[model samples]
Target chain A: MSTGPYNYSYIFKYIIIGDMGVGKSCLLHQFTEKKFMADCPHTIGVEFGTRIIEVSGQKIKLQIWDTAGQERFRAVTRSYYRGAAGALMVYDITRRSTYNHLSSWLTDTRNLTNPSTVIFLIGNKCDLEGQRDVTYEEASKFAEENGLLFVEASAKTGDNVEEAFLETAKKIYQSIQDGRLDLNAAESGVQHKPSQPGRNNLSNDQQANKDNCAC
Target chain B: MACLWSNSNEVLIQIPLTEEIDNVTFYQISVKVGEIKWNVKHRYSEFYNLHNQLITDHGVSKDILPSKKVIGNKSEPFIENRRKALEKYVQKIFIFLRQTMPKIFVDFLDFHLYDIYFLLQDLSLLCFTKGDLILSSSRVYSFKPIELYAINEFLKSPAPNFTNSSKQLDLGPILDLCSQLDAFIIHGCYNDYLKSNIILNKLPIDLSPFKIQKGLYLSNVSLDMVTSLGNARETVTTLEVVFSNVKRISDILQCDILHKNTLEESQKWKVLETLDLSNNNLMDIDESINLAKNLKHLILDNNYISTVSDLTQLPNLENLSIENNLITVCNDLHRKIGNIKTLNLSLNNIVTGKGFYKLYSLETLNLSSNKITNIEELECLGRLPCLEYLVLNGNNVSSSIDYRVKVLEFFGERAADIYLDNEKPSEAELDKVSILSALRIVKEGKTPDLSMNGSS
Candidate 1:
């Protein structure tokens, strides 16, 4: 989202999914392009964006996929849930129905991704306090009971948008450091580039030879 | 620079009023694009067909538009609600499709006369009127830059500011301009290709009755005879004879009401370059293709041609597209289309690359979506010296982990310049290819190139 990810150590795939018209695309556009899309139409299928963010001194590229059409096109969005390292499940704070639909969205996220996937709950439209329908207390409690990381943010005012994305990346990077995520697993949704330039000559050759011999 | 704002699409729908014609009630919906506004007196069924065409063609959701009513459709409340729904539908579709507005959507709004597509119709019509001044024997045919550049920029000089530019063309007469300009093309115009620079923007009907010299593009509409004794028949360059339901090429030309001498013993389309015969029922390439002795490009997509036959006679044919056919064999295809540079055999039933070695001039080859299953079946492609772009996308071998690297190995180190599936080799892919190359050298009982380091 912040640009110049042509050089990065690892790529973490993220999917920002929520009900239709819940400002999911606005949140992503605010994070990536650093602008408020004033009269943006909700995306049809899937819109993709990327940003290079430094996590624990490592340049980790976050490839985010923002999607639309929940019930109208669930079949297309379901395929994106897989191979996602982080899932930012969003809901509009002004609309209680969007908040109440969080359980079904969380269920799809949990059932599709691996157990190590970091899911963060986001209560969007926090700037609209007078129109807020679902209180922050109940949403935080719902996140606690469901064992999910949660935040109350505003895509319109760009509040806590960075925290919601970076905190999830930090947790995913923490899992890699703790060795909970097997790097060799293809479905891990984390690609760690080995011997990234100017560091290894002998080791990279040995690694390629080892892979070739196995093949 | 004086004021700043976002460039957003603003859609306004005036309150629709009910008008009755004979006994049927209709909605006169008026919508505005930018500063230009127009009214459409369309029935709900007509709106349904237009919006449905846009959705089906452009992949927009069909649920945005309002549904028809079985009861109380003419009631004031129902009319008001449907008007709001249509407004929202137009707003949403305009936001999503403003950049690449589909033809159906533009036609629905009658914006074609104001948008860039209108330039093509205007330019063609203007050129035809100018061509009337010179005789058919005149060799000089060129337009002054002022004639083309200044008039073409009629929309831009005032710049119908897509946001607020108020320049407008009369919306009513331009509605039927397609059929009217099509009449000009069919109004016995010779060198039709040269007059319009060979690009006609989607003519809707058949032009079989008249003399079309350079290009004859007919689609979906059937024809009794493509018989024309035009003076420019000897110099006709492009001919697209698709979906006319003719089995033999002679069926297109063997009948003529005006001139029997044009077909009598032989009809030589001497310099014909392009012949498109798509969505027809031609079972095989006809021997009548020898008629276009200098033909360069032939498109036979969506036909029932089961074999690669009768094409060897068109010696100058360089490009051949036989996609979506029942061609199950290409064992001797190189003998037929050997000199062709680019070949599209996608969506066919062919299973092997046998006899492809003789296709030494081949450059770009699309064998995707076919029955090619394994690597050994395509081993003969490595022998071609000029194979640069190879597309094997829907084949079974593509699912393998190192499928890209294995395919690039066909070109050895020259794989660096080769493109597979329209993608340039990534750094990781090139790394894998180098390892495969080293392994191949080792398997041949020779010492591997140890001098080649990983960084290199």
Candidate 2:
């Protein structure tokens, strides 16, 4: 394993979901790679990315799954929602259809994910001011009514992209600290890395299993 | 300045019609990025896969490309259509490659071996001399690679200009020059690909093999071992592991996952204080709720609870949300939630305020979207000393007899805390309301008949 010198104590699993063409992949790319990918092709089954982020002085690795937003792909994508700690429900600000489909997306998320999953509604493509079809206030009100954290972010400009991902991580971390999220639950989407470095030199198979357990 | 520099944004991708065997046209594409030209001969299906992969990996919008067809897809006309689409697709891909400058795409190009071999085959064909294949000579070679043949075809085509700054070029020497440049560039590209493969094999962090697992047992702990291993271990940071679409405890607790008296329940619900029994088929809270000793917030929204009788047993309950239920009356509800700070009973059948008079510590209450038609219900709510905020929107009582002023006068000094229809009475609005109340008291010697106009 190429883990850096400092040991990470936890790994958070996240899933990005929305209707097709809402920039879920772009948002993931922006958060993971810190660059806006303008012409990102549609996600097929699922795409994955990881970044080690710090929250409350803790270095947390975010394992994000970017799922295909196409409706037919939902059968394949639905399975990925099982252990997500956070779900970024995105909608394109330029397209009302994406926003209108939020409830359906939310239903899937709420139905499939654990109750403690932190769902953050993202109004993407905020950079396209002229083409905006959804207002921030309306989306925020929708978020408030649905009990979701809301933010207007532009993946192209990288505006609030960092905050959206980081905020979800922070909320999940808070839940862990508050003990709302059970670390040992099979589907809690949280893994507590036991702080024992002495037993780190185990056989390769055991070491691999230990690492997989931390995902 | 950025707009003026568009002319310098050079892209040189070679598309050659490599074959026409059995009427299935194949294009050998050599896409040049910097000094390395990645060459690949692909049929339409491979192009489709490439396009789809590009879309998935990069999130590129597919709006500009032609829609795919399934009927008669293998016919010559359809193949020709796909070939045209492929040309546009490659151009767009190059455009994206130029703009994003992603290292992964470059690696992806190098990783696919057939493209490199195709380019090498074209180079060796041009080399003519057998010994020169092994010769590490940097000298310029002869005929331009077959990949550039498509560029000449494009130049000869009668299509409209793809770019604004279009210029005509002499094809003869350009082809020669491109061919000569291909020898050294092709050699260098192959070397880099081989060298990187060696380095990649040597590295301890190749995680592609063990990363993907289909079963939940395998996926539960699988890390993006690639990124995690590469990340520097600075401070032992805390990680939040979220499994996707795991059955929530609400369903799991009521059904299969956790059995009673298992090690699972104690651990899972150890610090679980709030339990959401909302939108379930629950008729009422049973004795099972008493098990949650530390439970404070209990949400039973959208259920079938008819009364607040079952809630009295929750020893430490503070916030209760039982909205969208069949609750018709709340007679002495305070006896059950006397110390509760917040209560939400919206979207219910609550018709009277008889149960709320004694909730002295309750600060916030939501009674919206109910059948409350009796203005007298405000008196029961007004008596609660700690009641700071209240919502009664969508109730029949709200549309009766100056509802805001009447409610404000009833709340007295706490009128400023009243939230009617989500609108809190401002200081000025409340002051006016109180003055009107004082005038009415002085003029009439009693409160106005604030009852519903006719019914109830």
Please provide TM-scores, in order, for all candidate models, with all chains considered together: 0.39, 0.33
Q: What is the DockQ of candidate 1?
A: 0.01
lDDT of 2 by residue, A1-215 (tens): 11242255677889899999999999999987788887899776566676778877666767687887887666556656767899999999999999999999999899878999999999999989998889988999999999999999999999999999999999998887766887888678777655535544343342444454445
User: What CA root-mean-square deviation does each model show from the true structure?
Assistant: 31.6, 31.0
True contacts kept of each: 0.00, 0.00
- The list of candidate 2 runs beyond 4 A from truth reads A1-215, B1-268, B426-428, B436-456
**For residues B1-456, could you state the per-residue lDDT of candidate 2 as single tens digits?**
011113324445656445566766676666554333445566666666666766777777767566767678667677666666666777777676544433344333442232222233333344444334433453333222122322333344453322322221234433444333312111111122332222211112221112111101111222221222111111111111122122322232332224444433333332335555454456666544544544567777766677765454444566888889788978766435534668999999988777777554467889998998988777777766546678888999989887888887776655665666678887677777768767877798886543211111
Those runs of model 1 whose alpha carbons end farther than 4 Å from true positions after fitting are A1-215, B1-209, B225-232, B253-265, B446-456
Residue pairs in clash, model 1: A1-A50, A1-A51, B156-B159, B161-B165
Can you list each candidate's DockQ?
0.01, 0.01
